[model samples]
Target: MGSVQHLPYSVSNHCPLLVNKESNRSSLRDQRFYFEAWWTLDDSFEGTLTDIWESSSAPLVEKLKIVQIGLKKWARDLKFNKGDKKRRLTKELEILLMDDMDEETLKIHLNIEIDKDEVYWEQRARTNWL
Candidate 1:
C-alpha cells in the first residue's frame, strides 16, 4: 500500500488539527475570569516608613536631618574591602561630617536647640561615668 501523507491546513478541506475551537474559547474565558477575580480584590496597600516620612508634616530640613543621620549610621556600620579600608574610611568620615553639618543646620532652621553639656553628661552616664 502507498504511504499515507498529511495535507497542509490550506490544502486540506478538514479543520486544522492545531485549531481547537473549544480549547481556545475555554482558555480565553479562564483568562477573563482570573482578571475579573483579581480586579475584585482589595486595592489598598500600606505605606512604608520612608513613604510616611516623606509625606510627614515635619519640616523639610528636619526630614533631611533624619535622612542624613540614617546615612551616617549606614556608613559607620558598612563593611569595606581591606585594600580600600583607609580610602573608604576617609570618604565615609568626610561624608558623615558633611551630613552632621547638614543636621546641625536643620536644627538651627527648626530653632530646636541642643544642650552640649547635657549630651556630654548623658554620654558619661552611659559609660558608667568613666
Candidate 2:
C-alpha cells in the first residue's frame, strides 16, 4: 500500500459487468401451457377438448386437473411436432434454394413455407397478441 496510482477503472466496474452478464441470462425457461386460440381451426382439437371435458367422471376440481393434464400433454406434443415441422420446412427451403427449380413452383412452395412460419410465430407470441 505504498503507491497510489490514478487507474482508469475500478473493481466495482468489473463487478457490475459480471453481475449484468449473470442477470441477463435466465436459468429457468417458461414451462406453463397456454391454450392457442388458433387451435380451434383444427377439426380434431375441438373434439379432443370436448372429450377431455366430458370423459372424466371425477368432480369439478379433479375433472379440471384431468383436462389440464390432457391439454398440457397435447400442447407439449403440438409444440414438439410443430417445432420439428418448422425446422424441416426451413431446411427444405434452404435445400430448395441451393438447387435449380421452376420459379413458379418454387414461389408457391415459398409462399406456403412463409405461411407456416407465420403460423408458428403466431402460436409462440400469444402473450403479445393480447
TM-score top scorer:
2
Query: Against the unseen true structure, what C-alpha lDDT does each candidate score?
Result: 0.41, 0.63
Predicted candidate 2 versus true structure: per-residue lDDT over 70-119, tens digit per residue: 88777667656765655675667677777855456546545654565576
Model 1, C-alpha of 89: deviation from truth (Å): 20
TM-score of each: 0.20, 0.44
TM-score of 1: 0.20
- What would you estimate as the lDDT of candidate 1? 0.41
Candidate 1: which stretches are off by over 4 Å? 1-57, 80-130
Shift of residue 84 alpha carbon in model 1, Å:
12
Best by lDDT: 2
